[model samples]
Target: MRKLQFPVIFALFCGMVACNGKSGNDSTPSSEENIKKEEVKIRKPVDQAGYDVLLQYIANDDTTGLWPVPDQPLPLEGAVLPYNRIVAYYGNLYSKNMGVLGEYPPDEVWRRLDKEVEAWKAADPNTPVLPAIHYIAVVAQGNAMKDGKWRFRMPAHQIDSALAIAKMRKALVFLDVQVGLSTVEEEIPQLEKYLLMPHVHLGIDPEFSMKDGTPPGKKIGTYDAKEINFCSEYLAELVRKNNLPPKILVIHRFTKGMLTNYKDIRLRPEVQIVINMDGFGRPELKYSTYERFIRPKPVQFTGFKLFYKNDVKQFPHHMLAPEELMKLRPRPVYIQYQ
Candidate 1:
């Protein structure tokens, strides 16, 4: 795994106050009354219920850095758990090197995907399986585009095809984004309409988030906590506005540099986070990476990615079994095959 080239200049501005054309000491009784009236006129109604819930979960001084990983079927009062152990086939419709997703026709892909799903179901009989199609909505390209961003976004029809497959499987759909020169903030809103759907979730590939303007695949890229937090907050807002179950925000990482500021990430009840190990190697090497990179830095949940071609390229002739993966300390609740 390559290290991120830390930007030389990083600045954060905090809490600058604005003046309203009135001096601090110039308050007469009439002026004070007028200011109070103006404040009342502009103030928005408070969400008392939301505030009450926040207050209930508020941490004290001693518990400042002690945020617990959310449990399976995240308990959010009345909200129901949408899915439990997600098994997804990951890739795009255009690239064969990508994964099994684009290697075969739709019917054949679904047939193979169903077999994997059933294997997971048999392995984790206690948890219901949610089949998923993790489509690469945006792919990193070798050549830069007109904007000098070496990325090509799949058209809406490509995504619709994945959604249709998910519908056929009664599964969830994840639109994976690989931001080459673009920011997550810029790319995510483009999929807002699709994300608004109940069964659709999101996956952000930090491996292609080239923050330093380096073309993707030349070197591994990175995503700081701020970027990850932004995606989580965006999904949380959508959950709140739509009255939907908690949304899962998957961040792919197999190296330390791929994700930064792990402690500063804030998780909410409205969103579940999965820090997925996205590298492929021999079974032992893959397990070692999972242990070293992912398991040690536990997020709300965990995910492991398997590469059908890449995983067996080394000495090993088989991928890690679901039972072997389940034996991980914090078992991976989400599994993706590429």
Candidate 2:
């Protein structure tokens, strides 16, 4: 039951880190038709480092300053202390009109990513030190590639850039997958290389994942326990195969129908699963949603997201403090301040 002593101060830091990127596609035969059917061979997984810093922060509950270690230490003038035990420094990058991951010259993406890393390295220490969570998924619909009929397609180069940035920033990269026609299981192979990186993670959106019978964005839920398990097992096996530490699996839940088996999600002992209640527009709804779906999960970690403009309309610009959120069961190891 630790409270964020200076909730406002923590909110400022969280605000700086939450960045969400966007994705789209055009006319084609459809991904299923376009992709060649072949026996998916097990690629040799690369051995990556473990989540030492995050584990330490959670084990001891002592992240006093901003995470990712800023290049410079800014003044923490009137900041309060005795804050929450665990929280993540969410990083977002949803700029408009960007080139594709593979299509974009490596230098361009690297430069942009590097600049962000430096900014984080410099700004982090000035605030509280929370684990850094990078939002690597494309936020917009137009960003995804058109592979036949499939609208949202994740390109290979995109995943590579994400991994490179994650390694450089010493942060966790959460691949925000917008589930359209492709299922979670379908994207693993493409992401396998990045997921091999120590800093990589996954976030599934049931919001975009329409049920077999339901249309997109409908109240109908998209994935069930089976899909969730498929992801869990894949990540777990990758971690084990590469002799890497546990990896985090993030799932997005907004409405009651997004994910029906949230409470029943199988928790893998070797893997960390963060159920992030992603939505905005209303503070009451956000908090209410978190309480009902996230707070009650048996899992050890949870995530919360804050929108800059979304919260400004309803409640005070700054909503719940880090300390206040930490009080929730399992504590929030993954925090997305988007």
Q: Give the winner by TM-score.
A: 1
Residue lDDT tens for model 1, 1-338: 12333332221111111133233434433445778976654323234465333322321121323223433223343222223688999999888989888898888988988898888888867667778899999888898998888888899998999888788878888899998999999999999999998778899999998977788998999999999899989998987777666678889998999999887788777777888899888988888887788766756667889988888888857888887876665667789999
Q: On a 0 to 1 TM-score scale, where does candidate 2 land against the true structure? A: 0.59
* Candidate lDDT (C-alpha), each: 0.77, 0.52
Q: How far is candidate 2 from the true structure (C-alpha RMSD, Å)?
A: 23.0
Predicted candidate 2 versus true structure: per-residue lDDT over 1-338, tens digit per residue: 24656787777665444321111223333445444422132233222122334333443343433222222111111111112211333333333222223333435544644443344335333334333445446332422346421335446665555556545545456676655556676665566777787656667777666446344444434667778888888987876676565666777776666666654566654465666777775667777887677655434456677654465677455665555554444345555654
Pairs with steric clashes in candidate 1: none
Candidate 1: which stretches are off by over 4 Å?
Answer: 1-83
Model 2 residue 111 CA deviation (Å) reads 16
Write down the RMSD of all candidates, one decimal each. 15.7, 23.0
